[model samples]
Target: MSSRSPAPPNAAPNARAVLAANLIRLRAEKGWSQEALAFECGLHRTFVAHVERQARNISLDNLERLALALGVQTYSLLMP
Candidate 1:
């Protein structure tokens, strides 16, 4: 028997949730706050908060900027 929980209705994980989790994890690993990350990525603090909350969709360019600021590959931010 599997120990995993039942899959979500869509079966696939939400991209925004994955991105939010990754961002939170990476930021914690770096000992940075949302404002610090936003400053590093040249984005507004509210924008970073929105991203973390999955309140809005982000652009490819903004995604790339976030990845660059975090020193991670752009694709990693989208990984499930």
Candidate 2:
């Protein structure tokens, strides 16, 4: 038999990409600019852009702040 391990069952998809996509959609839905969202989240606009692009790995605390700014629960960001 081959040595490769079997893939785990019911593994979650990538969290960062899911979060980024949700953030982008929510911002668009609200008609808010990245700068505006960042301000509301107490974060830098550039950082928000990076987060939305999934170029930055955001911490849980920052994710919570962004979720709160978007008027959503933190778990919403992780939704598919």
Q: Which candidate wins on TM-score? A: 1
- Residues 41-63 of candidate 2 have per-residue lDDT tens digits of 89999999998876788999999
TM-score of each: 0.87, 0.83
Clashes in each model (backbone N, CA, C under 3 Å)?
Answer: 0, 0
Query: CA shift at 15, candidate 1, in angstroms?
Result: 0.5
Evaluate residue 12 in candidate 1 and report its C-alpha lDDT on the 0 to 100 scale. 82
- For each of the candidates, the C-alpha root-mean-square deviation to the true structure, in angstroms, is 6.5, 5.9
